[model samples]
Target chain A: MKTNFRTAVLTVLIGAGTVCSAVAQDATTILQKMDEVMYSQKDMTGKNKIILIDKAGKQEIREATIQQKGTDKRMFRFTAPASQAGIAFLSLPGDVMYMYLPAFGRERRIASSAKNQNFAGTDFSYEDMESVPFSQKYTPKLIKTETDAFVLELTPKVRSDFSKVTVSIHKEHFYPILMEYYDRGGNKVKEAKYTFKKIGNYWNPAEIEMTDLKKGHTTKMQMTDVKYDTGLSDDAFTVRALVQ
Target chain B: MKAKITVLLFSIFVAISGKISAQEENNIKLSGELLTDQRLLLRDNNDWAWNENRLTLKLDKQISSESKFYSEIWLRNIGLPNAVHSSSLYNKGIIDPYNLEIREAYLQINGFLNKKIDLTLGRQQIVWGTADKLNPTDNLNPYDLEDILDFGRKRGSDAINLQYYFNYDFSVQGVFIPFFQPANMPVGIFADLLNPSIAMPQGMVLNNFSDTLMMPKYNLGESSTVGLRFKGFAKGVDFSLSYVWGYDGLPYSSKNMLTPVNMNGETNIQSELSFMRNHIIGVDLATSIGGAGVWAEAAAFIPDQDMVMTTDLSALYPGSPEPVTQDSVLLKKNKPYIKFVIGGDYFFADGSYLNLQYLHGFVHERGSEGLNDYFFLRYEKTFFNEKLKITPIGGGFIVTDWGDINENYAIAYLPEISYKATPNAEITLSAAIFDGKGDHLFASLKDYNMLMLKMKYSF
Candidate 1:
């Protein structure tokens, strides 16, 4: 009777392993799909309102213009909040970044070693703004599967501020709506949730909220006038563009 | 002072209400700012001597796909108080301490060569250097140095600027100014140390031997200034090479004639300051390394003529009789010098930002050697979700030699605190504390230790 029970447990264990492997493979496919749909071959332009909520529940609103190309280059120019207007940020490949301030009337090339620093006093860090292809930066493993979404934990291949990131991908559209960043101890320190809207042929995030658990503050970004497939020239991404 | 503030407040209210009513009916976009600035003296009876009511209107409209118009008109009324003793003699409304002024106006067109070239014309400010806060190579706009401490206000020059982009990494920019406007020099008690005059006995007068008298004359049509800049990214750095043919922003002279007069038991002295034209070749570079932003700006100026500070008693004014003795005179040369600044900035995750920079005036000649160097730092941190920011700043030149620079070094501390009362309004409180040897730059301003507060609003 003991031998029969052991054989039956072995068969069930093998079946479960196969199912888990299948789900893990599906997770990889889903990540690839998200990357494919999330990026554009041409350029894109949009505007966003950055609402910063402090610990006291007070809100500070800032408006900005966002432009992105492929997966490597992006620029954000502050347009509202008179004090912050004309402040700009640009991130290019090679982990390079630049910032322009109206007060300085010039551009500053941000150093790579500073990548972990906060970006423009926001909850997001400089690395968070780097739009490198996720497939290039993180290795994912399917941790769980639900009826509507799949949970994947990603470990960065390079040195990163976060040891691991947990992401939730929607099953139907393969879009990432939730990302929780974890420290070495696996404690959740920060998380971001995105709301996606289908525009023409693309599914894009219309709103994003990132909350810092330790700081007790949250930053919510709402996109407006999002346009894709713009025929933006490469010159617009080069260093010469900062002067304007 | 209370009445003046009330008048300004009433005016701003009227202006804002008018704009709101007209904004919805007009297609042209309009925005403006109103500033109530006051600088209180910590050492004197003047509660806020540097008080002013400032307004700026920014307008933009798209003419077509290829062109647009942009302009910002700034008007400020600087109220008057009993002028500082050292500066009262020169104030004679030369800079118009209380008046209206237009700051900037420009039209932009992008119609040349498939939109690869663009032009900006009209009165504009062309800031040309990459250095943070302190740009040694920027010489295009004349400075409004009415308040030498207020370095942010740049008097725009009327110019036509053209830019041609050669691919993404390179561009050539040029500007032309038709007339020369010398930098505004504020002569006050603080100026005594830097430009103190030799004591004049009764019946003594000083004059310029040159044909021009008090002010240097420039032909409106012939005294045009030109500038060229080629800026782009190379290797891993953003660099620029610039050339400017212009006059010195500060008025300095080669010679002076002193005259003495005794009329009706009164003594008076008169003096004229001369200026020289100069050409500058500047190179500026900006790059990043090791988590800091690094920048450097250097300019080499070649004066058209050697500066000679001449005091000749033999040559008197046309109306006065020449001296019989032909007293001896003093002659000195203010040779050319090079100015450069190197700086770096680092920003931390917790909103702590620090920038350090050094500036120097280097010369080859021993007696005419300009100055040694020193560095400055501005450290800032934000708190309470950027609602509040505190900054501590200190910087000034380290002086050497008595001909121009005096005292070993000057140190200053300017701590500022600011609060964002609302999305459109802000209040700032700050103080300037200076210390140094008796002759250093900071020590000369020992009398002006100040606490300043300002409130600004934007629409």
Candidate 2:
């Protein structure tokens, strides 16, 4: 009777393990679907307006023109703020990046280690501004499931500023609605919320708000004149284009 | 002819602006900044080193989908506290201290003949190299030394630039400058201190001294400058190879004469200074290794001819000398010399930045033997969400001679603190201290230690 009871317990444990594996697989699939929905277009161009708010409620605004091709190439050119005008940032595949300052009249290579640093004094880090899809950088596991969404806990595959990130993805569309970022010490340090709108058969992010809890600062980016599948050539992402 | 060219460029700019204005899809941009910089020396009798207010205006207009016109202008009121001469005030109705400068005015046309070709004409700055401030390969434009503190600043040159792309990762650029422009030197007390003086013999005293500057003529082979560069990127590395045929911005003494005034030991000296022509071949590369950004730039300068300074001492000792004697010194040999800079920068996890560089030569230093080694470092940290930045350690160490560095070294320390009072306004406090024991560049600046305050606003 004791042997039979042990076997039954072993079977139940194995069954639970199988269920966990299935859930993890489901989570990865959902994450990939989210990435697919985010970057469904072949190319995209938009004008972005960023508003930064300090703890004391002071606000500063910046404007930029953003262009993206595929899921790897992206470029940002600042158009507003006289001091920052004509500054450009280009991100290409294999973690290559460059920054151009009009005053210098040349492009400077940005190291991969600078990914964690804030971009242009904004709350968004260089990693956050990257055009790479999340599925390529993080491994996800389903932590919980709600009536309207599935909560996923993601661990980075490579070195990163955040230890882990928790994302709440919509159940129907597989688009992320909110994300909470934790530091290496396992403390929640930042949060990001997204608003998506369907623009001619594509789910486009209309606005995104990122808040740094430790610094008591927030950055809100609003997208306008969004265009998708514009057939942008590869030449547009080159260093020559960046300086121009 | 230069005036005609300038007029033609402006006429083209005006015609393009008119054509673009008639189109409803034209886009025009206007931006600039206002700045006031004040510096004071820290000495027994404290004095103002620099007091100036400047206004900059930039205009950009899109003429077509593949063409654009851009211009920048600066208006400066320098030496605000200096008194105007009564004679000048009497001659002119109002003695305005403000001066206007056209910094850049260029017309850029993309896809000139094909999709891979581009052309830019008029006054512009053609910057090259991969290093930060100490780029040995960036010599197309003459240095702008109006403010010595503003290092790496360059004046715009009137040129025709053409770029052709072989592919997305590689391109070639050619630039032709019709005229040569000399470097602008600093004014005021610094100028007097930096002026070169003649070294006289022990027995002879200098009664009078005179000098003449000999500039190159306005001819294609004499005054014109040309440059070519081939740039490419591969495996996450950007590289460039460039060649420039031009004259050095600084002049060298070419001829000297010493004449005896009387039987006494008093003498008069006359000198002639001229610029040296050279050919520079440069190579530079920039890449990231193990998370840190690294760059290196090197230039090999080959002078066209040997620089010989002839001092005619025949008149100094007329009767006592057995034969007429003329002293000739070889200032610089017609050999190839190199200048290079290697640098790296990293950002720490705690929001600190560190940049370091090893430079083999300064701008004014030419010959291989005359070049001094320098190590530069800058470290800074930001506080209060990046509103305040403090650079506690920033400056360079000059080693005049590597063998005897203990006694032939100079150290300069620059500490700065800047605060962003508002989104568009900033205030900065900085100081430069120098100490040295030998004949390095910084040794001459030991007594010129200064404190500076700057206020800038952008609109």
Index of the highest-TM-score prediction: 2
User: Candidate 2 vs. truth: CA RMSD?
Assistant: 3.6
Q: How close is candidate 1 to the true structure, as a TM-score?
A: 0.82
- Which lDDT tens digits does candidate 2 get at residues B1-459? 999999988976665455445443468888788999898899987788887789989888877777788999999887634446667765332354677899999988776656788889899989999998899999899998777667789999999999999999899999999989988876755664335657887888899988898999998879999999999999989999999999888887887778888768899988888888889999999998888999999999988788777777778657774645455644445578899999999877667888999999988787888889989999999876677899999999999988988989989999999998876788999999999878666777788899999999888
The sequence of per-residue lDDT tens digits that candidate 1 reaches over residues B370-424 is 4456667888888766678889665454555445444555666788999888877
Best by DockQ: 2
Candidates' TM-scores? 0.82, 0.94
What's the CA error at residue B12 for candidate 1, in Å?
41
> Candidate 2: misplaced stretches above 4 Å?
A1-3, B1-25, B80-85, B88-96, B262-264, B318-334
| DockQ scores for all predicted structures | 0.43, 0.67
Residue A29 of model 1: what lDDT? 83
Where model 1 places Cα greater than 4 Å from the true spot, the runs are: A1-30, A102-115, A184-186, A238-244, B1-27, B44-47, B81-97, B187-222, B260-269, B315-336, B362-368, B393-397, B401-407
Report how closely model 2 matches the true complex, as a DockQ value: 0.67
Q: Model 1: DockQ against the native?
A: 0.43
